[model samples]
Target chain A: MREVAAAERRRRTARLLVHGALAIASAATLFPLVWMLAAAFTPNDLILARPFRLWPEQATLANFAAASEAYPIWRWLWNSLLAAAAVTAGKLALSLPAAYAFARGRHRWRDAAFGFVIVTMAFPTVMVIVPTYLAVVRLGLVDTLPALIVPSIPYIGFYVFFFRQAMKALPPEMFEAASLDGAGFLRQFVDIALPNVAHVVPALAAFAFLGAWNIFLWGQLTLASVENKTLAVGVALFSDIEGAQSSWGPLMAVNSLAILPVLVVFLVARRSIERAFANR
Target chain B: MRGAHGGSLQTAGLVAPAFFAVAVFLYLPIAASGLLAVLDYHPATRAFSYAGLANIEAVWRDPAFRVAAWNTLVYCLVLVPAQVVVPLLLALGLREIAGSRLAPVYYACLFAPTLVSFSVAGAVWLPLLNPINGVLNEMLIAIGLPPSRWHTDARAALWVVCVVTFWKTFGLNLVLWYAALMTIPREQIEAARIDGAGFFRRVRDIDIPLASPTAFFILVTTVFTTLDDIVGIIDVLTGGGPFERTTNLPYLLWQKGLVFFQFGQASVVALVTIAIVALLTFVQFRFVERRVTYA
Candidate 1:
């Protein structure tokens, strides 16, 4: 009985250690973000004068106003939203059909076609930048939101792979039953496969939005005008224009605006997104 | 038989858009880049001239390209293994508290930084690493140590970039590792325990084998992103340098093309970077594929 109690004690100690270590690691990992939040709320002078504090002595909305006045932050935020939404819809529209075809449609080169799309995943996105930029320039799409959105959607290798996997897991009999009912490939896809795999769509949508919202270098390279810039690209430029002095608060406020929407989206889709990665 | 027969046109219709878009945007660029590497294109003048091997040869012999190549290696070496191992270990630890109340808290906190863009991440860290009244230095001074220059110093710049990039990127791997860990049959670990296997032994004998595919996946993705994602971070944090100490091949590609508009030099850098990527990926398949097969 004493020995069993000792074993329980040892296990409890191990669990405590694990929890403690994780807490510290998580805090360290979150330090920069936490600092950004704190600095965002504090007044500009205090931000420059004092060291990092978890909570400001007094919080203010002045920085948000300043960030907006200094740059077209609201415009940038809208541009970010428009770009992210378009890219997400484009990814879903393009990939869903392709993935469904790969999963269910009949073609001799079906696998090869899927391979053709999926192999692009290995092409490090930067490798294609110079040429993609030239294509955009030649097509007169630069300095436009479409410059960011249209080229961005072709990165659907993972989306196709993911949705394809989700569709493959469906009951094949459903498709056959639809086929027997004279529902063609389109009907079977729309009525059967899409409905069945609806659960995974939001998770992919969340990822797509987050991915597009965070587009940086491409946004910088293409959206050269101030108002045309997305929030991700704007924040970097904001810091450059503001420098690190009395503007730390506004700098961080803009950073917060860039991050908070994604945080809310992550929270909303947390369970489904967790399930998505956990399963595959 | 149902799987074998469908209207060819319908199937083609379903697949054609993504097929064409990817081909045009993704594959066409490689060809474009190949041509651009050999022929000079002046953006201002809109003139193209055949330069033959001059661009490639110049890039091959350039000291800056050599430096960037070396730095890229440094990033891959430091980050690839660290990304895989740190996250795996954390996932292993988190398994102890998997569904506990604090589990989601830890997940959120660790993942919070990832939701932010790399530029925002760099912005967030900029103030913290600020040489003047920065928190890091303030804490150092509190402990009676001098506040060191963070990313501004060429010697410290690369490590600073690596840390920021690691912090920004590791959350995805951690999540992957956690997911992989969850799928391991609990009974196997329990069986090992009944057989007197310790934790490390079980991780080696069961968990590693079970999680090897995810580990392998993480390894390959980490390798790719280590060379790719740091560009934004480097751009925001150090702008690739006090003396280009932190610039990698991707940054070099950006500088050569967009910044300087040397289309030929930029295309050469792009091609060379892609070649390196292809080589690394091939090496991973040759050596790592054997280990990833246990799944």
Candidate 2:
């Protein structure tokens, strides 16, 4: 009886320790983001105040107001949305047919071509930026949305490879049966393969949207005009060019605003995002 | 057979638009980069001449390129182990927790930063790490230590970049590690436990070996991705400042090509970066393939 009681106590102690450690780690992981949000609302004077408070004594919208006035936040957001949407749509439109072919079709050059696509995935985007910039400049696409959209299309190759992997896991018998019914390859892809990979669409779209939204190096280099600038470039406008001094309140406020869309998409589609990452 | 052959052709034909698009958009540019690397090309002159090995020789001799490569190597060496090991440990530690409710919450917090842009993260961390009026400095003062200039100080700047990049992506490593951990059969662990193995022993003997494949996957991918994907961090954070200590090859490539208009040098650097990544990836696949056993 005494031994049983001792064993129960040990089990309880282990459980307590596990819970404590998890709580601590989770808090540490979340502290930066939570602190960012907290500091954003804290009065500008108290933001750097010692013994950072979890909750601010006084809150103000002044930071946000300043950010809005200092930059074209709304316009940047709209441009980002439009560009991201176009990129995502173009990725799907271009990648779907390619992925279907890679998955179902047999050809002599298919493996070679697919290998080429996968190899490009490993090449750093920065390496290609110079040539791509030259191409855009030659085409007179610099400073236009087309410059952004055109470069983005290449990235869809990764998505094509991803979708093809997913499609390959589907039963081949279904495709064969569909083809037996006289449905052309395009029709079969549209009627059959499209519906089956519906789950992946949201996941791919989320990935593409985040990539487009967070795109900075390209946006900063290519888009010279403020009107063409995405939110990332727009947010970057807060830093003083000569001194590198940034307005603390407006900078944090705009930074928070910049991340809000992606955060929303992530929260709404958390499950899909989880699946997308988990699959690989 | 004829019908099947025709169908295959039709499928290939259907896929042609995407194939052509990817080739024209992605592969062609990359190929062009290779050709440009060997040529004396200038955007201003709109002229190109064969430079033979000149660009390659210049890049090989460049001090900045050497520093960037060294920094990238150091970053990868420090980051890859921490990213793979810490997350695996955390995930393993979480396995003993009783309630399932806390798992999702733990994962949510861990995964949150992965979704945020590195640029925004950099912007957010900048104020937090500011020297005088920054919170980090204030905390140091509270602890009775001197204030440290994080981004401005050359010695500390690369580490600051490292920390931010790690924070942004560690959650992803955590998630991947967690999923891989879940796949380790309970029986294998329990059997080890039954055989008088302690927790550490079980982890060392059973878990680590089982998780090696996943670790290898994460390691190679992270190394290549970090070498390539850290453009956002560099662009936003220090702008490769404080004497360009934080500039990786990717950032250097951008700076030389676009900012300095040194196309020949940039192309050489780009080609070198690609070659290094390709070599590393090939080596990793060869080494890992022999050890990775998928059931």
Candidate 3:
């Protein structure tokens, strides 16, 4: 009885130790971000005040107001949304069909062609940026949002890879049965394959949406105009443009705005995020 | 003979659009980079002349490129191992409390930083690390410790970048590690415990071996991301400043190409970095992955 009790006591202490460590680790990981969100609401003068805060002592919308007045902060947000949404839509439209074909289609070069696309997943972004930027410049699309969106859509390598995995997992009999039912290739893909993998779509879409939303370098390179900048690029340059202590609240507010959309999607789709990485 | 369905024409039709997009944006640019590496551009004529290996030689001899290359080496050496191991350690801890009431909360808090953009990651850390007005030093002083410059100091800037990058990225690997850990059959672990395998012994013999494939995956990705993913962090936080002490190859490529308009030099840097990454990734898959499965 004493041994059992001692063992139980040891387990309890170990559990307590683990819990304490994780609590501190989690809090330290979140401190800067939570402080950013908090400072976004704190008045400008007190944002830099000592003792650090995870909550606004006196909350106000003045920071948002100031950020919007100085830069096209709202417009940048809209632009970010427009570009990210289009990019996500384009990724799904392009990748799903290709993934469907790769999974169901059998041709001589099918695997080879799929391999060709898969290879792009390994190409570092740096290798392609200089030339892609030059191409966009040649086409007179620099300083435009389309320059950002159109170039990024081709990064469907991972999307195609993931969706192909999802499709391959579906029973082959389903596709065969659909074909026997006189469902054509397009109809089979749409009517049979699409609905089954529909559960995976939202998760992949959320992941893609977050990726597009957080694009920084491409946006910085392409979008030159103040208003044309997305929230990420614009807000990254916020301090450079507004060189004053007063810019702190507004900068934090805009930075908070930049991360909010991705954060919400992430929290809601947390399980899916895990599954997405797990399956990959 | 059960064959996967669809004719060549059908496959062609479905795959063409995506292939076309990738061909234009991805393939064409890759080809262009190769061409630009060997070609010289004159703004006066807006034309390219074949310069052979001149661009490569120029960028090869550059003192700044040399510094950037060395810094990148340092980053990979330090970050690649840390990136792989730290998350696995965290996952082990989380596993201890896997089903507790606060597991999800702790998981979410660690991951929240990952959801932020790399540039915003720098912005997020700036307020807390800002030299004069930052709260970190305030807390340090409060604890009776001498305050230190964070990113502004050349000696510490690269380490700061590594820490931030690791903090932001380790979460995904954590998710991966957690998933891999959850897959190990509970019976095997319990059976080992019955045989008197202690915690460290169980982790070493059972957990690490079981999770090796995921470890390999995390290793390759950490190598790739360590080289490229921190460009935004470098750009925003330090701008590779303090005399370019923190500039990696990718950041240097960006600065040279767009910022300095030296396209040829930038393409060379891009090619060099790409070669290093490709070789490293290939070596892992060839040798490391082979042992991972066989051993």
Candidate 4:
């Protein structure tokens, strides 16, 4: 009886310990964000006075007002949404067909073709930037939305690889049936292959959306105009303009704004995001 | 098979658009980078001429290039291991608390930063890591410890970049590790427990090997991201500042090509970075992945 009691006590202590550790780690991880959230609502002067306060003594939306007034924050947000949508759509449009081809098409050069795409994933954008930049300049696509969206689409290596895996997992019997019914490759792809991999679409789309939305280096290089910049790039510019002035509240507000859309996207697709990352 | 050639041609047609985009935008640029590495560019006249190995020699001789190379090496060495092991440890901790009411909440909080852009992340940390009025310094002072310069200090700048980058990115690997852990059979663990396997023993003997493939995935992706993705955070936070202490190869390329218009030098750096990536990837797949015991 005493041994049973002692083991129960030990288990309880271990559980408590685990929970406590997780709580602390989570808090530490969240401190900066939570602080940003608090500061975003608090008045600018109060943020400086009460740096450690987790709650705003007097909350206001003026910081967001200031952010919008100072720079084209709304425009930046719109640009971000437009670019992310375009890039995600472009990636899917390009990748889905390519992935289907790789998974189902049995040809001598298929592996080599896939290899060519996959290898580009390993090469960093900086490696290709000089020539890509020159090409863009030559085409006069600088500061255009197409420049932002078009070049960004080709780095679909992981998407193709992932979609291929998803496609490969689908039962071959369906494809065989479709083939027996006189379906060509394109027909099989659109009618059968896409539907089977529908579950993976939201996850991939979320990832592509997040990736395109958060694009900094490419956006920075291509989007020269203030209005053309995405939220991520604009926030950096906003910080540069406001950072030295120590305008914490408005900056935090804009920072919070930058996180909101992705946060919504993330929440909506949380399970899918987790599943996508979980894949081997 | 009937119409096999025709079917193959259809497949080729389907793949052509993506292939064309990749070929023109990606491969052409890569090929051009190699050539550019060996050629000199006149920014004013927009002229390119073959310069032999001078670009390579110049890149090799530059102190900033050397510093960038060293910082990149340090980044890979430190961040790669930390990115792997820390997430694994956190994932294990998370695994312990899995299925609890708070598990999802814990995950959401940890992953929240990752969903934010690097620029926003940098912006979020800027105030927190600020020297005087920053919350971090405030906390330190409240605890009776002396506050220190975080990202502004040359010695601490790279480490700050490391921390911010790690913070913004580690959750992806954590999820991967957690998923890997969840896939491990509970029966195997229970049997091991019955056979008197201790926690460390079970982790070492079973969990580690079973999760090897995920570990390998995390390691490769982490290395590439540590090299590639942190450029934004670096651009925002330090701008490779405190006397260029935090400059990595990617940042160096950015500064050289775009900021300084030294395209030739940037191309050299690009080639070197690509070679490193290719070598690392080849070595990982060729050697390390061979031993991964996939379930």
> Residue B71 CA error for candidate 1 (Å)?
0.7
**B13-90 per-residue lDDT for model 2 (tens digits):** 857877777688777877888898888876667888999999989888989989988987887788777777778777
Instruction: Going through the candidates in order, state the TM-score of chain A alone for each one.
Output: 0.95, 0.87, 0.94, 0.93
Recovered native contacts in candidate 2, as a fraction?
0.52
The weakest ten consecutive residues by lDDT in model 2 chain B span B1-10
Pairs in clash, predicted candidate 1: none
Cα-based lDDT at residue B252, candidate 3:
89
Interface alpha-carbon RMSD, every candidate: 1.7, 2.7, 2.1, 2.1
Q: Pick the candidate with the highest TM-score.
A: 1
lDDT of 4 by residue, B1-295 (tens): 4221126777787788888888988889988898888888888898988899999999999999999999999999989999889878778888877779998888888877888898888989998998888888888998999998999998899999999998999888888899899889889988997787877899999999999988887878888888888999998899899999998999999889888888889999999999898888898899989979987
**Whole-model lDDT, model 3:** 0.85
TM-score per model over all chains: 0.97, 0.92, 0.96, 0.96
lDDT string, candidate 3, B1-295, tens digits = 2333878888889999988888888888878888899988776676878989999999988899999999999999999888888788788889988899999899888877888878888877777777787889889988999887888898988998998998888887888898888878889998997798999999999998888887887887788778887888888788897889999999889888888877888899988998999898888888888757423
lDDT of 1 by residue, B185-234 (tens): 88888888878898899888888888888887888888878988788889
Where is model 3 more than 4 Å wrong at Cα? Answer: A243-246, A274-280, B1-4
Best by DockQ: 1
Tens-digit lDDT track of model 4 for A1-280: 9977986797678777888888888898998899899999998888877677777668899999988888888988888999998999999999999999898886678889999987777767777888888788888999988888888888899889899998888888888888788887777888898988877788888888988988898888899999888899887888787656488888899888888988888777777766665656
Question: Chain B vs. true chain B: TM-score for each candidate?
Answer: 0.96, 0.91, 0.94, 0.95
Give the distance in Å from residue B63's predicted Cα in candidate 2 to where it truly belongs: 2.2
lDDT of 3 by residue, A1-280 (tens): 9987987898899989999999999999988888888889989888765538879878899999989998999999899889989999999999999999999886788998899887888877788999888888889999988999988888899889889989999998988888878887778889888999887787888878887887888888999989899987887788665543346788889889988888777667766666666543
* Candidate 3 Cα deviation (angstroms), residue A188: 1.8
